[model samples]
Target: MRITDLLKQDTAILDLQAQGKEAVIDELIAKLNEGGRLADSQAFREAIMLRESHSTTGLGDGVAIPRCS
Candidate 1:
């Protein structure tokens, strides 16, 4: 799906100040929660962590795809 379809001004944290991986995830989740994209942040966070445990999202292109199932 197009990111523009889901991403909006409210959900985009252009000035993220998170200092670490988990922290960044938390910050993004908070943004999504604030934007009404998630009904349960903790549960989603757990899922993302579970997925991360399988393998790193880093693609060696300075980008990471954080996903949860």
Candidate 2:
């Protein structure tokens, strides 16, 4: 599925403060939870982590596409 499909308006952060990939992932999860997309913060965090493990979804040019099933 497209990343935009999974990206909630309230959860999609632009120019996040995190310094690394993991931190950026955590920030996304937090935003998703805050927006009530996931059941809880932990579940949201895990979902992003699992997706990243399979492949680097970064589409290059400083753009990253993250999706969860």
Candidate 3:
């Protein structure tokens, strides 16, 4: 299916009220969980946190692409 098809109204946070990196990640993960996107939210969170420990994912211009396995 197309990515647009997977997009949902409840999963979209128009106003991101997070300040820092971890907070943003937490907020996003919470949204994903609320929308029933993942099997284990805690595991996904730990994986992303571990990845962040290596280095920041900033690609410049106020952009960050955090990926998880």
RMSD of each: 2.0, 2.4, 2.7
| lDDT: worst 10-residue window of model 1 | 1-10
Task: Give the candidate order by descending lDDT.
Answer: 1, 3, 2
Clash pairs, candidate 2, are: none
lDDT tens digits by residue: candidate 3, 1-69: 344633689888779899899999898889989998878999989998998898887898867766564
Candidate 1 per-residue C-alpha lDDT over 1-69 given as tens digits, one digit per residue, 9 for 90 to 100: 455755788788778899778988899898889888887989989999999998878777556768865
Scored by lDDT, the top model is 1
The residue ranges of model 1 lying beyond 4 angstroms of the native Cα positions read: 1-5
User: On residues 23-61, what C-alpha lDDT tens digit does candidate 2 reach at each position?
Assistant: 877777777667876676787667768988999879987
RMSD of 3: 2.7
lDDT of 2: 0.74
Q: Which residue ranges in model 2 land beyond 4 Å of their true spot?
A: 1-8
lDDT (C-alpha) at residue 30 in model 1: 89
| Candidate 2 C-alpha error for residue 68, in Å | 2.3
Q: Model 2: what TM-score?
A: 0.73
TM-score of each: 0.82, 0.73, 0.77
